[model samples]
Target: MKTKELLFGACLCMFTACNMPEKGMDVDVYEALDYCDAQVQRTLTELKAAEGTIDYSMMPRNIMDSLNTWHCRKATKDEWCSGFWPGVLWYDYEYTGKATIKEEAEKFTEPLKFLSQIPAYDHDLGFLIFCSYGNGYRLTHNPEYKQVILDTADSLATLFRPRVGTILSWPRNIEMFGGHNTIMDNMINLEMLFWAAKNGGNPYLADIAVSHADKTMKYQFRPDYTSYHVAVYDTLTGDFIKGVTHQGYADNTMWARGQAWAIYGYTVVYRETLDPRYLDFVQKVTDVYLERLPEDYVPYWDFDDPNIPNVPRDASAASVTASALLELSTYLPGKKGEEYKNAAIKMLASLSSDKYQCGKSKPAFLLHSTGHLPNNSEIDAAIIYADYYYIEALVRLKNLIENKAVI
Candidate 1:
């Protein structure tokens, strides 16, 4: 509840900053309306400048370039993260109708298309193929991209382990399912399954996703609305054993990123199933989330861990929540939806104006992102995924308010 108090105060301050004249109306909504439009323009400008060239998008020009070059050269399949950018670029292409973005994005996507051909796929497949090609097919009605999505879905469907009754979170032979079976991260994976089902007319794939969701809800969620970073369940009987904190302080302690993933994940689930339970879950988690947030609208990496005392906050979590709130807002029916929309808008406004980093040389993207505390990795730094999701959320909010597009 103290966190809620902080969130309300943060919202109140944002409201005042936007100079709203009315009571019971969100000043953040109007301000966000303006901000979303401006952000798209700015992002498009950058994308245009990139011009779909590998050398430009490569290192020496962008940190993403450096990161990708490192991944391409050094990291193995397991360590090669950040494969989500191509999909993000595709997302931008869909939203903006920019041919240049599409071209630049394919430079990233074409290789993944080959990877999808492999019978054995990995977790990043959903992030790469579904987010990019699947989205492209959905928007453009392109048959080739649609086939790519199906191929990827088929591979993912095969990855489902009957032992856990969930898709294998990692390709490792080790049996650890904690955090890998995380309900939060799997929601995005479910989106791919849903698309696969709709496109390929394979109801089984959709059913597999839904079943996994059902299992996750049963085992992972706690009574207090706080989520575990990882929960290992008996695949056979669906029993809970113990939770291992994959990225947070320890088991059962809330990781800010995981929490954000859950917030957005549950919101995505609600959109898919329209289960009242999902909505209730969202409200409960959002309530707990809003209650615990710091005044700046960013969250410390770990909610329960107080050892650091004065650690840098994960602004990436804020960006994720801002995006999730925007999606969750659209599902609202009438006045209540308006309130959620306003809250989301306000959160984004605070993020864009106060937290967002702007400059050419400033590598990664967005700003104030915290990756992990234990290893002292990219602590409180800009992250590309943060920028991608932030842009995704902002664009979604614009589409929602302007066209009233649901889902």
Candidate 2:
């Protein structure tokens, strides 16, 4: 683990210029942290300036994609992305210990109280509760936050069907046509269940999480370790219906974010359970991702899409994969760990560069994240989750350098 910090110090001595690192090399840790701090300060100033014009009733939201302008658009608490803005604030508070940021985090968190009471939370409870209240409890040790997370876990557990051995991702009535659908994205939500079960919610919740992962490992992936976006199941018999890609280029194509989710999800599963199979799976899938990624370490919206150089890049996928790789590197032994860490370092460097990092003119930090390309939605735009994961990766890197707990 000390290798990451040592590498940073070594790079400092090798380079004459402090801010500049050779292309594909890791930037100095101090410079990276300064970049994060500057981004946070700029975003906070913008948020405050927009206070009078933006609605606080549904406070935190994404800066909608625009041609030459950016503005926050309100989303309901149940919306999958609603928790990320507050999560960003919490990350800022965690990194800087700034009281104003913590106050703002609480302000945005207040609006999400209703999510815990919603009976049908689908598969996004982790993104909704864990990212916000979960991190809040971790930092503040607040009993109320703990209770909210537990209740949200309980709400999420209702979506699990024993026959399917997985949680339902979307409601059956939703336009997406699967009766008992389970998406690779749902795997990301299992962390909250694991946390709740370990923290006195219910031991069965942990069992549910493990079962879901096991089933996903069996069904959602291709022979090459790439993943399908969706796995439809027979609600009555728990049989597989079809493996499809809803947000990808085509059914056979590998959606960039789906692969990112698999990498992050399995790394998390290994963290929670110390399961060897999960680690093996992560290594295999991450190998494919690293091999397929372009020279800069960012990937196109879909890996299998025939359009190569002209395709839109998904910064969100790169950010998520980098964060996961940082944690995964810690768990690997010797040179393998260093390899993953270095790759992640390269990713952070590329992302921090002007090519992807949003300028002060934009409301968001990371830019060029394709939310759903096939749907003609949010393509090559700034996304909230991208910023959240980028900040999380930077803080996690800082924590590792300081010999602190990462998650």
Candidate 3:
């Protein structure tokens, strides 16, 4: 009887230990502890340096507007680009376990909600709701945050054009129809819908989400495996436009960010559907992306365009690509999956190797981010999203290797 009780206790201990995640694989978490500590120290130093809180709002609105205009400014606060950092910071808090980032993130979230209150529902609401409210719910299990996610998902579903069989990019402005029938980054929103179905028991959201993926595979993807940033279709006639361009070189050029979206987006689709098309899309895109990557393992902002002399490289794009590759690797088969996993691992390694990364004390960030054209204010600054995704990729890799998951 004594021997049996001891044996049972030992087995229980082993089972509990097996369920816990292993340490040391998550380098970003360790690094971020130091980084966020340094940031908190510096921010406190700056606060001390300021004699008083200077009222920037007292300055004329024209000056404030002019200051903002010199950069890649979005027309509205609710557009997708505006939500990127909030999402990234949300990830940062999860990785680092720092309360300061969460506090700063809360400050950022209030303004986003203020903007969303006018409630311009579009393709990007998922970005905001998922990052701000969804993440908040994940961390705090706050019912208010969960409601925010549900309401935002409802807003997003309304943007679905039954004609195009996908969500419209813009809900209020018809002029912003560049993304009319385009199934680009909007695919990422499916996760929000999928969560809705599972959590709120709304299967309609999940059904439409999968249907959108199918429609995207049919229309936006090219034979060469490239994806369109904006696949404009006639809202009235439902006809295809031969070529289109939004932020890239031509309508045909593969914008690196859009490719990142497809790579990650399709992987999410595969997770739910287990549909072969999503898997095929992942394989084809990863193959092309890996082939075209620069010697540093980071890619240019646009994969198809020739390298312009002295043009800035987009580290943010590289970060996004790395993140997507990490996610896509999980769905691949056998040795093929290992290859994809190795490629993502290589990219993350190269990013951390100092050739492409920022030095430790700028305090602004730690990635080589590029934005807009040369004339833009944020043209070559290290962006927060780059840091966010780079850390996310590292954490994801840690999870896969340590968990002994197939990827």
Candidate 4:
């Protein structure tokens, strides 16, 4: 570590003085796409070099050291973030139609096949399999990948306790959490189950997803729609226990990324079911988050943090919500649709500005992403999930502009 820490203010001052695109300006779809594709290529090439020194079978996680290189992780159950690096390659391949990127995506994705073969180790099977294989199968209908996704969905379904009405997120930490526990992040894993049920997997899979989402909507949120990071239940009786947080500033505060996942996941739930119930509910959740954000629309790590400007911002949360709102916009009509679209564009504008984008110093796309600030881990760094969603949002924005379909 350096003697003088690189705080958010100092970083902002440097990027501001360089004057890379004004923050309030609208994003040009092609221009932003070009920038993101280049960043993805840089990430791929740089990670290829680092693979020999780091673990070859691992995936990029975050950049922490002054060297600005990726801190990668193996594709183990605990390493829930391992799937995103391959997912980024797949997105680049979809944009460029380049065989080189597809080849690398396959190489990275093939190792994660073990996720389907194993028992339910954790709830991240969706993040592990869906983000990589789901995108891969969408771009290229590889039958092998389709089977892997179905199998993984079945594996994920094992953790569901019917009485609790949600999937247990961290089976390994059940005792630590005091019972059957579901986090806000578990809402995201529902997509794989929904997808599998529609495809060749079990029909009950969709039922499980709907149950999980309904339970989360009922118990995971307060009256104001702000959410808890973790909601625990009795392991034996399956009764409602208490709402808590594993990653937020506290049990009562809104963790920015937890709220982001709720927005994104419910948007998916609404899409799959076409349920007006979810559609109406998701906007309430999203509106509360938007109303609380800072001027640029990028959120601080925790909205309730006592230290405001001095605290780190979560570019990843902004990225996730940007992608979600773009899809949410399509379902609505009139002014509401346009408003959602414009909000997402403004977020993209701020992220595209040098205020957040890491031009050359970092191997990843953007900077100032806080991952587990309370643990003092990966604060204000280029976490790989941020890069993944940023690219996904850019592609979605471009698709909406071109009158094409969004993936």
Q: Which candidate should be chosen as best, given TM-score against the real structure?
A: 4
Compute each candidate's TM-score over C-alphas.
0.79, 0.91, 0.78, 0.92
Candidate 2, clashing residue pairs? none
lDDT of 1 by residue, 1-407 (tens): 99999999898667554432235433244454344334434444444335542432331112331232111221123333434566566666666577876776666555556646777545556765766576666676778888888887887788677666677666562365632354356556777787778776477987887777776767666778787766666555646666666678877778888888888877877887788888977878887887887765667878887764577677678777878887786677676666566666565665666445443434334556677677767666656567667666666765664454634
- Candidates 1 and 3 compared: the better one by lDDT is 1
TM-score (C-alpha) between model 2 and the true structure: 0.91
Error of 3 at 111 (Å): 3.5
lDDT of 3 by residue, 1-407 (tens): 99999999898657634432343222343454355445434433333325754221111111111122112223254445545445555566766777977865565455555433544456877765675666667876877667667767776777777777777776554556643555477877788888878788467888879878877777787788888877776777556654354556567777776777778788888887788877877788768777887776666776766665355566767777777777676666567866776676566666665565544434433445555442353445556556656766766765664564422
Model 2, 32-121: lDDT tens digits are 556666766666565554444334435334454564334465546447887888888898888778898798788778778788887865
Q: lDDT for every model?
A: 0.64, 0.83, 0.62, 0.87
Residue pairs with backbone overlap in model 3: 116-119, 244-251
Put the candidates in lDDT order, highest first. 4, 2, 1, 3
Off by over 4 Å in 2: 1-24, 48-54, 59-70, 75-77, 173-175
Error of 1 at 31 (Å): 11
| lDDT of the structure predicted as candidate 2 | 0.83
Query: Per-residue CA lDDT of candidate 4, range 89-131, in tens?
Result: 8988888888988988898898899989989988999998999
